[model samples]
Target: MAMMRNITIGQYIPGESVIHRLDPRTKIIATFLYIVLLFLVNTFSGYACSALLILLAVALSRLPIKYILRGIRPLAFIIILTLSLHFFMTEGHVIFQVGFLKVTQEGVVRGLMMVSRLVLLVVGTSILTLTTSPILLTDGIESLLKPLKGLGVPAHELAMMMTIALRFIPTLIEETEKIMKAQMARGADFESGNIFQRAKSLIPILIPLFINAFRRADDLAVAMEARGYRGGEGRTRFRVLRFTYKDVVALIFVAVFVVVVSIYF
Candidate 1:
């Protein structure tokens, strides 16, 4: 479970950089816009521009390059699988053929494009999560969704749930690690076993995790009720969020990147 040990969500390194200081809502919106534009992109030049923009954002976030790459390590297998499938399945002029496997130029090009798109998308979104704290992100979401309240949506409740879930991801991962270690200490061999046997060994871990999760939920509910927690009725926020000049500048830069990619690529 060494791989699982390093999994993190809502993981942010404290920083005072420009990317870190922007409104969380700005980061969220920019991420969405960037993903949409990435798909609209269809040329190598466009991808290059997008990559450059992503690199610039990552640099501004001031997070270590190793940490960002580590966050993406889990996706390496999927990216390779996608590239392989595209490289073999698409039809075009055959570039290579061996042992009944045919590779085409178009397939190769398409595979590279798809892989690039996935990489850029992951890096772009990870930047937002890596720079902004989960609490702030959820607060931004709730504030943004306030308009939906008119449509009878339980926006505040939904946002609160999301925030709580995000906050607990790291905690749950640590708990899972401890459970795995404890089971291993009791001679529970997860490795060197058949798939079915290994899966059965996980039952001990899963049962406790589920039980504890439910217990925590119940306790939280009781605490909230004791505090007279009503659902979004006149709830006041502790920290009010406001977009700053940095947010405007960021938006402008994103817009320019989009336009340039669209026109030149």
Candidate 2:
């Protein structure tokens, strides 16, 4: 369960670097455009351009490359599974054959490309989450979705819910680790069984986890009530969000990135 403790995907690191100082709205929009660009990428040249931008962002953020990438460790199995499925399912000129299974050169190339796309997607999103605080992220999202409030979208509430969920990821992970250890101490075998048996072993853990989650939710609700909290109606923020020249520059950078990757690169 050590994997559960080191989840850094949604966790933020405090910094005063350029990337961190930029408006959260700018980061959110840029991250979305980058993800779309990743899907449009097919050639090595496109990937190279994307990678260069990522490196530049990392450098500007003053965040360690390894620290950003550590989030991928828990997802290693998923990456391998995706690559394996594409390698065997795709058909082309057979490069290797073993009885009923065949490996094709085309499959190899496609699998590698798929892996690259996945890695880029994760890294791009991680950059945004690592640099932006949850409160600022919520504010940015609510501001962007303000238009939908006319259609009864409850934008502020939705953003608040998402922010709360992100904030609780690490807490949930730590809780899961504690529960797993307690169960293991009671002679529960999680690692010495087939897939079905292993899943069955998790019943004890899930029950306590759900109970504790509900309890925590109740406590939070009580606390909010005690503080006289209400919905987002007529709420005024202490920190007003403003779009600066840096935000405009970020927008231009994304526009150029999309144009070059889609049309020329």
Best by TM-score: 1
Report every candidate's CA lDDT. 0.87, 0.87
Q: What does the lDDT read for residue 243 in candidate 2?
A: 94
lDDT of 1 by residue, 1-265 (tens): 6787665666677799989999998899889889988999988878998999889998888889987787678899999999999989988899899877889999999999999998898888888888988889888888889898999888898998998797677778888889988988898887778899889988999999999889988998999899999877787778889888888988888988887787778
- Summarize candidate 2's per-residue lDDT along 80-186 as a digit string, tens digits: 99888877878899988888888888888888888888888888888998999888988899998999999999998898798778878878998988898899999
Q: How many residue-pair clashes does candidate 2 contain?
A: 0
Question: TM-score for each prediction?
Answer: 0.87, 0.79
Query: For model 2, what is the error of residue 181's alpha carbon versus the real structure, in angstroms, after optimal superposition?
Result: 10
Clashes of 1: 0
> Which residue pairs collide in model 1, if any?
none
